[model samples]
Target: MKKFQVVVKCSLGIHARPAAQIAQACSNLRAAVTLETDHETAQGNNVLEILNLHAAKGATVTVTVDGPDEEEAAQKIQAVFEAMGPKEKKVPVLKVAFFGTKDYDRLY
Candidate 1:
């Protein structure tokens, strides 16, 4: 088994696009791959699992690979994490106050 730790550099963190790309890369490898952060763990080849980790920018995540091609898998998987650059800012959703029909609704 082989592994490496990396910090997320992308501002948006490990969102959909990078997660998909990382998953695809892991899928192409012969080794079984996995990733873990302080908050969560994910199967490296599974986009949904990776996204569920919510590894925010500057967060550290460990990449692990075990199998016939563990070394190469580690190298490539590490690259996927490093490839993501600074995050781009997106428009924020506007939230509004809601009025309730009953006095009890004010608790919200």
Candidate 2:
């Protein structure tokens, strides 16, 4: 058995997309895994179960994995959580200081 804890940092928290990714990974590994919030524990191999956990931003959860490939599965599970964390927007923030300056900044 292996265990790892991750605190969610996604902007909108843990939603269906990330949950589904976790569930698919767990199912592919054929490992028994569970995701636990403060008071609820849900099977990691099921998308609905993970989504139901309702882990919001800054929430911490522990992932437990038990199987022949427990270590590998645990690592994958941790990666899944890490991948779900909030990422910067692809479009760069353009700042145009045209109020006092004559030249406007170029847009990306």
Candidate 3:
């Protein structure tokens, strides 16, 4: 068995995309992969379960892989987490100025 920790960096937490990527990483492996956060544990290859973990930003997740391909599975999942790290928010920033006034408003 092998275990490693991953920090959740996605602004939206462990949402669908990361879950899918985690699942895909384990698709061809012969190991049993599981992910555990402070509140929950999930099967690494199951998207729904992975999502269910609700690992928010900055959450530490423990990845555990056991069986014949444990090393490969662990490495692949680690790569996926690294590749899925934090993303820039796409929200538009807005700035407004009032006429004849040194006042401005900003929205993120």
Candidate 4:
């Protein structure tokens, strides 16, 4: 399993759109993805489950990817979160830092 933690930079947190995007990122992957907050754990491919995480700004989220395509799946999901940048009018400030991984750096 591949595991990493990130802070939610989006002002509004993981709402419908972000959740949908996260779900979409995992839709075609052969690996299983999961996101976890302090109080809840959610399936990365489930919009409702992601929304249920209720991760607000600055909330730390742990992402886990396992199975056949973990590397590809992880990269895809990371891109989705990275795309939620300052340019995104709907949900600006969305970014993440992959904790403990040399390949990732903090966005903010």
Best by TM-score: 2
Q: State which candidate, 1 or 2, has the greater lDDT.
A: 1
Worst 10 residues of 4 by lDDT: 99-108
**Candidate 1 lDDT by residue in tens digits, 1-108:** 887889999989999999999999998888999899888889988999999999999999988889998878888877787789764679899999899988789787
RMSD to the native, candidate 2? 6.2
lDDT of each residue in 19-64, candidate 4, tens digit only:
9999998999989999999999999889998999999988999999
Judging by lDDT against the true structure, name the best candidate. Answer: 1
Over 4 Å off in model 1, which ranges? 87-108
What digit string (tens of lDDT, one per residue) describes model 2 on residues 1-108? 888799998878779899888888888886799899998899988888888889999999998888899988988888888898767779879886534433443332
Give candidate 2's error at residue 85 in angstroms: 1.6
Worst 10 residues of 1 by lDDT: 80-89
What lDDT does each candidate get? 0.88, 0.85, 0.87, 0.87
Per residue, candidate 3 scores C-alpha lDDT tens digits across 57-80 of: 899999889999887788898899
Could you tell me which residue pairs clash in candidate 3? none
Candidate 3 stretches with Cα past 4 Å from truth are: 87-108
